[model samples]
Target: MDAAIEQPTVARLITAENREVPVSATLRYRAHDPLAVFVDFPAEAALDGEAVTWTFARSLLDQGLRAPAGHGDVRIWPYGGTRTVLEFHSPHGLALLQFQAAALRRFLQHSYQTVPAGQEDVGAVVERGLSALFDEV
Candidate 1:
């Protein structure tokens, strides 16, 4: 399996005033962090003019596709027949973004191909974390 996978897609930022702004986003999955997925946004999409990345459980994304999921930081739910809504909360504020359901589904499917569900190597993940932590000391 590849070390990482990245799927670039466009998302519509749902403004407070009920407007949609197109934004570029990427869905990323890493073999080292098999249980998690990441969403990367460009600096322009952030208020601070810095690139931002959000990490959340892969299971949360899978569940969110079918129904509402998450209680903190990240929340996702199906918006309608063809769109999905992702809500991200931070100390600064929150963002509401809508993405094509098909795009998300495709990305998730590709990620599963890289590291299938229920087949994540937990022992390797822990060992790598421990090694990195100790190396920093």
Candidate 2:
């Protein structure tokens, strides 16, 4: 299984005044199971990095897309970097979480590869991804 997602990556929250704040220890997702993501932080954390998980179910995830919101907006790969970005906007502010592309791909390859392109549902895709991780190499 990929361990990178479990590691403490930096979670930055950009305020209205363009200030960066650390709101969580790490924003984690297990395989393709966005719902299984663990958001470790305070309720009063001010910003939300985990909201990106909802985008998968909401059909808002894309390589270079932004969804407008009240506070800021959600953006994915705004810079077209090697890393996949998940940006979340809340009434409080914006949260940005970066994921290493390689680890993320490995973590979810089974889901994306096994399912027909466009036929992926959140749960089945995630189950396949997790099974791949648990399966022997």
lDDT of 2 by residue, 1-137 (tens): 53225434445565667776664544444444543434455555633433223333222332332322222365555334455556766665556655554444443443344333465457776678788999956
Question: lDDT of model 1 at residue 98?
Answer: 96
User: Which prediction has the highest lDDT against the true structure?
Assistant: 1
Candidate 2 vs. true structure, TM-score: 0.40
**True-vs-predicted CA distance for residue 31, candidate 1, Å:** 1.6
- In terms of lDDT, the poorest run of 10 residues in model 2 is 62-71
| Pairs that clash in candidate 1 | none
What is the Cα root-mean-square deviation between model 1 and the actual structure?
A: 1.4
How far in Å is the alpha carbon of 26 misplaced in model 1? 0.9
Clashing pairs in 2: none
